[model samples]
Target: MTFSWRRRRSGRGGDGKSEVFKGINQDMELTIPTHFRCPISLDLMKDPVTLSTGITYDRESIEKWIDAGNITCPVTNQVLRNFDQIPNHSIRKMIQDWCVENKSCGVERIPTPRIPITPYEVTDIRSRIVAAARVGDARKCQELVGKIKDLAKESERNRRCIVGNGIGSALADSFESFARFSVDAHVNLLKEILAAFTWTFPLDEEGISKLKSAVSLRCMVWFLKSENDLSSRQNAICVLKELISADQACVDGLMGIQDIEETLFHTVKVPICPKATKASLVIIYNMIKSSKEKSGEIALKFIRMGLIHLILEILVDGDKSVCEKALGVMDSICSLEEGRENAYENALTVPLLVKKILRVSDTATEFSISSLCKLCLGENESALVEAMQLGAFQKLLVVLQIGSGERTKEKVTELLKLMNLCRDKVDCVDASMGFKYIKRSN
Candidate 1:
């Protein structure tokens, strides 16, 4: 198959990284050499890399093939003994030279590609990390972890290779061992360790379990305090979210830490990054979800912390996804009497939820509807009357007409029934005898 490169001006992408091979000039016609083209993509190779089968292709093309579980070379049909793709530096140089020669033709030189960190190198780093941790060499451990963090930040491929080599678990183990001693002298080391752990997200089961340990929890809690830097606290909260989600037991020990509740509340009350804020919300939701026995007690605790008013403020102008997560927290909170009362008392709560019914995504709509049902169905006809006044009935009709999930539809139907029942009691009441007397005067 023949491939054509689209013409475009060279510039950086949204990530602020230089655009690769996007500077080809279509107006100035020039024939690209066959050897300079990737066999898989049939396009000019941007980062030509030779595989074990002695055939060259673009790094992206080959990586995609291997990631799709292909074991054989695409050109030779020979089984790949290893996944290594060595950079064809000579060919790359020749390509650049050709581009320089054709400068009059508007040919742009392909930038030199950074070699991806190999698994072998990552394994070597892991070994040294183990040795350093074993000998209680905090200084060496810090240097090694810094290197690992740099590699992880370099590229997605390097991060994958680092995680595949079990660097995350190794770092966690090292941190635990070192934490057994005084960590005051190694504050920077602890910060680096927590940040490194955050970079290796979607952790394996072993990594999750290791992070769930008391030592790891203590370390995370220490950074979460208001005294630490924002980045350190952000990393700690992120890792804590992963651990708590993986195991419910993690939440028990985490909640027991002194000032942890205030720390988490402060983290949520003040925005760090979207990611860390979302993590904080998830942690709060999970805490409520896991402690079914004490769910009401937990809900009351958060309500006392001003969670109800705080989330109402979020729902006002938060993005669709954040609104959805915030609504989920509200749903969990509204499961209890105190939570429902707090929500009913908040003037923004009912109206905001009604607006979200058919406006946001289905997940958000579901949570909104569920929370609304809980609030209005409680020991007050006022919530029901206020909901109808906010045009909730009209929105529910739209939801039913357009159709929603079974659970959402059911809640909508139930809420409609309740509102329909409340209409008689609400509408019959006289609005104002003074207005009627004024009509008589007119």
Candidate 2:
């Protein structure tokens, strides 16, 4: 295959420090080579990695070489980075040999090395940024910050090089490396970095602890206090979730803040991606559930601050997974009898619980319907009667008949039994109608 080259030169001095290089324009036409094709694959070099013997190159090795900036095949000394950049003589011979060796094989071209920056360089810069961040040296920190930002912008400009790059991982690693300095750095600068690459926090076990220790809750709360944009605030919540999971100390710190109730409510109310919302909910639920002191107070605060309504909204509108999670939260809140009774006395819990059940139409999943039924039954007998009066029995029966899955039918039967036990309190006609619907469906 043919290959081409473009050189980018940084306007800076010849210190090999030029940030720019002029390379081959991607639009230029080029001639193909023939003799350099692979014997087994009969294709141009792809992801060519140099073998341990230093003579043969394979696809995986080629990829590492490309990622590591060794673009030329050592044995052939052929430029393998771009198909069009290959010498025409080599291409012609490779094609002729391929045709002679395999009459049915079509010419396969290798992928071009699109990214200009090497992974090593990215790693180097990331290390320097972390080192600078460590000493709390303002000037070095600012310099590294500028470099990281420029690299990000450069990556954006070079689509070929930036695609599938490990930029996010590098950024998160750098942030964690600077954990010791996080408390000392300028909060505004930290906020800027947090805002710029908010989505880099990894959810896996390896990254969870590093993220928590590196970023303080104070810094996160600070950013949330200063920033009004929902997107940035959402990122803050994401980073916080990582920390909340890894460090109970961080969770306690967050809980001890002067106006944490407001902060928690604000975070729950913010419109965010579903994954982020789920993470936040898990973190909060775990924190509240595990706490020994004032746990009920925190639960009450969530309800008082209108977060319960938001949770219900998600339950009603979100997909099955989210609905299941919402149920878990409701279950947790109601597990504390005092909190559940208080919520009932305030007249907030029953209406929302009833709404969820009433919304369970024929389309509702059995798990969601069952969850709602379970919550209702856990409440006082008065609450169950009120829910039946709101036409929940009719909806439950519809779900039983038209719901798609086995779980749905199973829950439907369970709900029917529960409603029958409360038959004396429910409108007898509604109960009878439900019983007839069940009998007819069976």
Candidate 3:
């Protein structure tokens, strides 16, 4: 609806006709002048402010327009003189008066808007948090942390202010500093620190490195086991993922932490958060992708902990994203003979792996075939018979006819040939067929 109004002149240019907005109540009506509404939002101005062009707009709408890199005025195409929003108290007060006058017509008055906190204020909070940490006063530090959280939630402008000012480094420094703190204080402090990282924008390379160096591995292990709050636990895992992922040396260090391994296994089975679960899984996958010796050790551990069972369960029940990760983790672990032994022993392994074929993404397809090929080609004859009895022959025929990537198709063909030779020995196949996709390039 277009609402228009003209200024009344001292002469007879004034018209008795007034624009009216009828409320749901038949007797109640309100009339908002066009000048009072923002051109961008088409809503009554809550905190009207004048731009460099002397054009009035709601402070938030114009501020966002400027923040988004627009230099021209919304109404007039003139370039902005400067990106300043001077508060127009006169117009704001007029809007408030109008809302008050129309109270019976269901038009509610807007509440006072809080100004965004400045970088100076965030820097001051960081100092207070540091001073509190120096004095070992957890209470004061916690209060300051709560204040930071409140300021961060106030606005996107305040959030950028927090990041631009060094809150990430402050939190990382604080986390490392409080390692020797009392148990309750340490856990509480860790929770707050992770909260800051989570709610703040993402960390830069320097900030991530600082946080990774500050990570106390022992405390994180205890956190995974002892912290009852799921969010805190998930935060701990996220921190580990960043630290371990940044450098291969960090992943090597984490491999020795038995508690880290144990808790990761626990999380895979009983998830705290979907993200945490995936991070935990990806960490193991990263370990497997690292040095061969270390990858084998982690794979054996995963088998002993029955992580394969949990992975298959997720592949069957979880979303496609989680399924792809699970498949990758499985493929990584299956590089070890012990891993292959455990997988083939499980009755659901081959069938479930086969079920994932042509169902999930192409990455899932490659991993599934790679895992099966590992078990069948390397050693375990018993695993080979298990694959056959579980309908591997039928699945391979379908796979050959439909086909995938050249390398994947090559692996499938090799498996078909290998299993075909063992047919009479295992006696597990009904029939076999050949396909043109398997033909060698001339």
Candidate 4:
């Protein structure tokens, strides 16, 4: 009997039943086993291609599945392709079954797993995110959130890997995708990625150096831009705080931006909310604190730009917390040689600071007074004498006497001593204010 297996036709036989046949016309025809049929092609598989599209069987057909991970066959609706390129022994078995069942000319089909999408895939995500954002599809926009999270986790792992390998430069290229996507997306994920990058600090000299470069670039963009959503702003500020430690270059890079100074002054004066005002003040304080040691040049630049007067304005407006922070910043600025030189050149910062102290109500006078005395007595004997002449002595003594804290009293006494040292320049009325208070108490 000839086992014809080349062509089959659907028909009803004489028995009145439907018939199925593999082939009908030729002798010695090879019948392809069910397993030999490509799950996707449902034919003898040829030129099998493993593509990243979640399709693994035909090079031509699977190319479309490359990015589509684990796609079902369009014809058979079977899970015919694995796009991730992750190795699975079970998938090997499926390919093996096809090889065993086919009985034509011997053809070896090697399954070449697809190459993974490079980290550059983040750009694709960024484009999609922008499109989703444009259409106001919060759901689609939110979907990118998961991808961003995955990217972030992948970036962190890569960073640790690079650090462990002592290939810090590797991390720089690794995170380029995350950084590029972050800026393109212009969302909170940028912050998350930045935070992850920063978490790898002190990894190695090279890694730390690369981190500084990355942070400087990111912060420069954030600080220089005038337009960003509140969440973006918050994220940028949070990252700034993280990268602030022991990175003078990064701190100066942030401070060197004109927009940061403008944003700060504008926001403090015309805040969108009290919370925003407070947050901005806190960021400023943190920036100052970060640059406290190596900030002399930048501090002087800001002073020359009249930042002191702006801060003084905030203090005089009764923003007690903000005022206190501004005062602390002033103390930091004046303590530095460059800052003092700038203050002397402007010839306004000391007087403004002293005036702020004198104007502060008695209830909140202690911190302001201490901050002023620290700024004035340190370098400007002349400014301290001017402060005493402005009735600052009376304010300081009153704070010393009635203030609940011993530190306040000690700070007041120290200011009096500094003032006494400059008694020749101080007016007698102002000079005697402290003694008169002391006599009354006696």
All candidates in order of TM-score, best leading = 1, 3, 2, 4
> Candidate 2 lDDT, tens digit per residue, 1-442?
4444232333334564321122324344323343354433434443333334343343433444556777565567666645222223334444445434432232233334333455567667656665665665546655665665655565343323322344444444445544335534555556555654543433344344444552445556656555455555676777677666555666766776667667756666774577667767766676567552554677667766666567766765776556656656665665565545544564545555556553544333443454455555554677667657776677666665555577667656766777788887866435444455444335
Best by lDDT: 1
Q: How does each model score on lDDT?
A: 0.80, 0.54, 0.74, 0.52
Candidate 4, residue 246: how far the Cα is off, in Å = 14
Error of 3 at 236 (Å): 1.6
- Give one clash count per candidate, in the order shown: 0, 41, 0, 8
Q: Per-residue error at 420 for model 3, in Å? A: 7.9
Global Cα lDDT for candidate 1: 0.80
Q: How close is candidate 1 to the true structure, as a TM-score?
A: 0.87
Residue-level lDDT tens digits of model 1 in 113-161: 7888988899899989989988989999999998988877777889988
Give the per-residue lDDT digits (tens) of candidate 4, residues 310-413.
Answer: 66666656466666666766666666666556555555555556566536454345556655666576666776777777777766665665664676676677
- Model 4 CA deviation exceeding 4 Å by range: 1-141, 144-177, 180-182, 185-224, 228-231, 238-274, 289-292, 341-367, 403-411, 421-442
RMSD of each: 6.9, 11.5, 7.8, 21.7
Colliding residue pairs in candidate 4: 5-23, 49-59, 52-66, 53-65, 53-66, 54-70, 54-83, 56-81
Best-fitting candidate, scored by TM-score: 1
Q: What's the lDDT of the predicted structure labeled candidate 4?
A: 0.52
